[model samples]
Target: MTDEAGSAGALTATAGGGRWPDLREVPFKPRAPWFNGDLQTIRNFLVVEGLGRGPAPPASRRMELPLNDGTGDRLLADYSQGEEGRGLIVLIHGLSGCSASAYMKASAAAFDAAGYSTLRLNLRGAGPSAGLSSDCYHSGRTEDLANALRTLQDQDDRIFQRGLCLVGYSLGGNMLLKFLAEYAGDFPVTAAATVCAPIDLAAASRWFDRRRNRIYQRRLLNWMLRDAVRLPLSSTQRDAIMAARTVYGFDEVFTAPRFGFESADDYYAKSSARRFLSGIETPSLLVEAQDDPWVPTASYDNVDWSVLPRLHRLSAEGGGHVGFHDNASRVPWHDRRILSFFEWVAG
Candidate 1:
C-alpha cells in the first residue's frame, strides 16, 4: 500500500494534455452470492462464458503470425474490427487460457463496444494454435510478442497513427510487462494493462504451493500437463511432466529445462516482471486483488512503487483472481476500468 497510485490524487495526474480518470473511485462491490474472495473466484467457472451474457463480438478474422525465430513456430489470433478511429487493443490470455477464454471474450466485447478493434492472441502452444508450435511459451517470451506486433503493424497501417494498447491476464500480463520494459521504444504501444499478474513469479509459485490453493494448483497443473503431453516432446519429458504434482514441480521438471533455465528458481528469478517494472516507460495500468487465491499480496507489497511512476495500480481488498464481478453493473469491473485507462492514454 505504499505510494498507493490508485489514490484520488494519483489518479488525476496529467497525461496526454488531459487529466486521467480516477478508476479507483469507480467502486467494485462483489455481486450477489459471490461476496468473498473464494466465491468471486469460483463464480467465474460456474457462469457460462459467451451464452447471451452480453453482445457477442462480430465473427473475427483469423490471422496467423509466424515467429521470427528459426523454429517455424506460429501463433494464431482472432481479430475483429471496431470503430477504426479509436485504435487497436491486443488482448493476451493467461495460463491454460485461450482467445476463447471467458474473460478474454468479455473484455474484447467491451473494447469493441468502446470503438477499439481487438485482437485476442493465443501464445505458443495455447488455444487453437496448440499444434502450431513444438516449443511452449514461457513468461519471458517477449520476442514472440514483438513479432506479433510487427506483423500487426504490417497488416494494418492505422496502428502507426492510432497506436496500440495491450491488455494481459495473469501470466500473459507478466509477459506484457516484461515486453514493455525490455522493448521500451520498439513498438508503437501507447498504453497497457495487466490483471492478476504474478510480477514476482517465484513468490507466486510459492503461494500456489500453499495448502489452501491446492485445488486451484491441481487444476492448472492438469491442464498444463495435458497440453504439454500433446506437444512433440520426448517420452522422458512427458513422463516427468505427468509425475509433477504441483505447479512448481512442473516448472522445475519441464518449463525450466525447455526454456534453457538452470532450474525453476533461476527461471523465476530471470523471467519475473518485478525486475523489469522500473524500466517500463509506457503508460500502464495494473489491477490485482489482494485476496487473489494464487498470486500472493506479499509479492505486490515487496515492490517500491515510487520508481514506477507510469504504472497505475489498483490493489483491491477483494475480487479474487481475475473475477472482478461488480454488483452495480453487468459489465465486468475490470473491463470498464481498463477501457477508461486506454481512453486516457489515447487522449
Candidate 2:
C-alpha cells in the first residue's frame, strides 16, 4: 500500500488505487477544537515518562463484575470515574494489556475530560485476577464481554440511564466488532470505536512473520508463552507448548486446542472481524494505521462496508501497531480522533 497522503479518499476497495484510505478524507467534524500543539513532541515526552515512571495512573479501582459464561469464570471489571456530568465510556485493552495500559489510561483521561465515566474490562485471565481463571481469553471469546455489557447496561439503567459508548484497542477491537455484529440490536451500545484491530487474523499472522516485524513478533509471542506457562494443562499439552518455535506454532499447539478449535485456521475463520463486519448495525468507527506492523492494510479490503451503513473506516498513514504518535508534542492523534467521533455521536 502506497503512503501518499490525501490522495486516497473513500473506503471503497478501489479507492486510492488499492491503497488504504487516508483518515483525513473521512467526513468527520470534530466536536472539540483541533489540538494545536505538536503531537509527536508530546508523544516523545510521554514515552520517556512512561518508560521511566512506569504508568502513573491510580492503582486501578476495580469491581467484581460477575459473568455467567457457564464455565464458572469470575470476570473482574474495573472503572475510572469521570467528572459529575459526563457520559460513560467502556474500554477494552489489547491481547495482553489490561486496564492499566498507558493508552487505556490516557483514553480514560480524555473521556473524563469530556465528563464521561470510563469502564475498562479485563478479559478473564488478565490483570489482578490472573489467578481467578484457569482458561485464558482468546480472540473468539465474546460471551464474557457480552455478559459484561449486560451488566453495564443494567448498572447504567440505575445511574446515568443515558447512552453507552465503547472503544477497544487491537484484540479488544476484534472482540467489540464481533460482539456488535453478533448481538446487533440486542445490546444498547449507542456508539463504538476500534483502533488498530487485527480484523483478519490470518493476514495479521502473515504480516507479523516478515523480517521487520520480528521484534513485535518476539515481544507478543513471549507474552503469550509466559501466560501459557502460567495456566494449568496436561503434561502432553505442556510439552507441546514448550516445543513450539514460533507464535503460529504455539497458537496451533496451545490456543487452538484449548479454545476447542480444530486448528488456528478454524479460529481465524471464525474470529476475524472482517467476516462479521457486514452484520454490524451500530454506529461504529474503525481506525487503522496503514503502517501498523501487526495488523495489515489488506484486511481493510476484505470488509463489506455496504452492509453496515453507519460504519466509518479511517485508515491513517503512520500509527505503528496501536501507536498513533502524530508528532513530537506527544499528543495522540487517534485519541483526539476517538474523542471527536464520540462527541459527535453523543451530540
Candidate 3:
C-alpha cells in the first residue's frame, strides 16, 4: 500500500513482495493467450533454451581482461563484431550465469542484427570462469565490472561517438548500476539497462529461500556450488561451500567472510544496489517482473525516481524474471526493449 524507507531502507510498493499489476500499463506485453506468471517464466526459459536461441553471433572471440590485481586474475569477455559507430555493449550475467547463457546469446544476436558490437562478460568466476579467481563473485562486485569497463575503454578509447552501453541482468544488473553510481564521471558510458536485478539483496535472499521458492533457490545454489568447488578456497571457504544448503548458507560461510564482510546481513546491506540508486546519474532502463521469483518489488518501489529522471523503470506484468517472451518466436522481447533503451539513451 505504502512504499517508504524500512529497516532495510527498502522502497517497496507492497510490504511482503508485490501485487499483480495491469499488463496494459506495463512497458512490454506478454505473448498472446497465456498470462500466467509461472507459465510465462517456464516457457520463457524453455523456449530460450530449446528453440529460440536465435542466430549465433558471427566472428565472436573470447578475450581475457587482465585484472592486474597482482593475483594474475583475468576475467573472461566475449566480443561480437558489429558495424562501427553503432556502439559497443558490455553484457553482464546474473548469479550462476555466464556470457553463454541463453538470454545473453539471444540478446547478443539481436544487437548483432542491429549492427551493434557486443561483449558478453563472465563476471569473475561464474560459468566457464569458475576457477579463474580464488575469490568468488557476489551481488555487489562493482570492482569487476569497473575492471571490464577500463579494459574496454583502453581498447576502444575514442570520443568521436561515445556509444557504449552497459547491459546487465539479475545480479549483474545490480553490480552494473552500483559501478556506474560509485564511479561516476570516471567511465565514459553512454547508456545502461538492467533486467530483473535484485537491487535489495537481503529482501531477495529471504524471498528466494521461501518454501515455495525453494526450487529456484536450489537450482541457483547447485550451479554456484559447482563453481565453488573448483576455486582455490581456504579451509573456511571450502567448508562453507561444503555446508551450504542455500544461498544464505553460502554467503554466511563463504561470501561474507571471504569478501571482508562481518556477516551475511552486512554483505547484503553493503552489496545491495537499492542504497545507491539515488547516486546513479546514468541514463538507464530498469526492468522488473511483477512475478519474478526472487528479486523483490521493494527494490523497485523504494527507488527515488525523482532523482533519476533519466532512469526509466519498466515493471512488466508477466516477464517472469528475465523471461520476456515474444510467444511465437524464440527471441525474447527484452532483447529489443533493451536495444531500444540503449538507442534512446544514445540519442
Candidate 4:
C-alpha cells in the first residue's frame, strides 16, 4: 500500500504516541456530508454502500462450527477464500450482530479480495445458532471462540498454513482482546485487531445510557428483548428479563445471574478488557474512535500501554464507532488498515 501523505516512512509519529505508526496517515474522505462523524455511524446502519463500493468477492460456504464450551452449543461461521491464500482471518461480530451483519460481510469481502481466507463467525446465540445454547452471548464470552478455533485447528490444516489472525468489532472486539490477553499462548494466533472496542465495560454502559447514544442502546436492547423471549429461560429468568428497561437493568437481571456474576457492576468490572490490556501476549492492534458515541475515549486513555509489549493502539480522533468509511477505496478504512497490519505481522 502506498501512502497518500507525502511521507518517506510508513511509521509516522502521531500524537496518540505509541511504538507503532499512525493508522490514518493518508487521511479519510467520507465522500458525503451526511457521512461525517456520528452521522457516518448512523448512515452505516441506514444504507448499504455496496452501490459505489464495488462488488464483493463471492462467498464460498458457511459451516457450522461446534463449540466446546461444554454446553454442546454450535456456532455458525461463513468461510470464504481467494486462490493462493495468505492466511485466515476469524471475524468476531459486535453485539446483536452475526455473519450477516453489513460490517462483517464487508470486511470479509475486502479480506477475501486481498488473497486472505475469511471466517465470519457468529457468537453462540447470534444468527441461526441462537437455539444452540440456553445462555445468552455476552462481552465476556471468549471461551466459546477459543473452543471454536481449537475444533477448527484439529480438523483443518489450512487454518494454520500461512497465519491465523482475529478481527473483531465493538463488543466482539473487547472479547477478542480479552481472549488474546488471557489465553494468548493457548492458541497459535499470529496477530489480532479490534475496531471500536468498548474496553471499559462500565464506561461503555454509561455512554449507552447517555441521551445522545440512546438510539444505539435502544436498538441493541430491543434485539436482546426479542431474543430473551426465545431463550430457554426458567420462570424466574423470564420474569427478570421482562423487568429490564435499560442496559444495566438487563445485565443485572439476566446477564449477571445467568453467567454467575455477582451483580451488573461486578460483571462489568470483571469482564472489562481494560484490565487485561497490559497482559496481552500476541501482537495486537486496537483501533478506537475519539468521537464514538457509545464508547468513551477515557477507556483507551487510562490504559497502561507500557505493560503491553506486543500491543499497539491506533487512536484516531474521528472514526465514530467503527464508521471509518472512506471513499478513497472500495474497502472501508479499517478493513484496509487491519489487513495491512495483519500482513505486516504475518511477514
Q: Identify the leading candidate in terms of lDDT.
A: 1
lDDT of 4 by residue, 1-347 (tens): 32232221366543435445445665656646645568768766766544434335457686787876677888878888755757788999998888877788788877877777888888888887786765668998888888888888876865777878899899999999899877768877898999999999999999889887777777888888887788777898888887787889999998898889999999999998888887787878888878788788888888767656678887766668788777676577778788767766665
What's the candidate order when arranged by decreasing TM-score?
1, 4, 3, 2
lDDT values, one for every candidate: 0.83, 0.69, 0.74, 0.79
lDDT of 3: 0.74
**Which residue runs of candidate 3 sit more than 4 Å off their true CA positions?**
1-27, 32-34, 50-55, 156-162, 328-330
Clashes of 3: 2
Query: Runs in model 2 with CA error above 4 Å?
Result: 1-60, 153-156, 304-307
Q: Which residue pairs in candidate 3 have backbone atoms (N, alpha carbon, C) closer than 3 angstroms, thus clashing?
A: 11-301, 11-302
- TM-score for each predicted model, relative to the true structure: 0.92, 0.83, 0.86, 0.91
The weakest ten consecutive residues by lDDT in model 4 span 1-10
lDDT winner between candidates 1 and 3? 1
Candidate 2 vs 4: which has more TM-score: 4
lDDT of 2 by residue, 45-111 (tens): 3562456432234334677765666766666766766666566778888887777777777667556
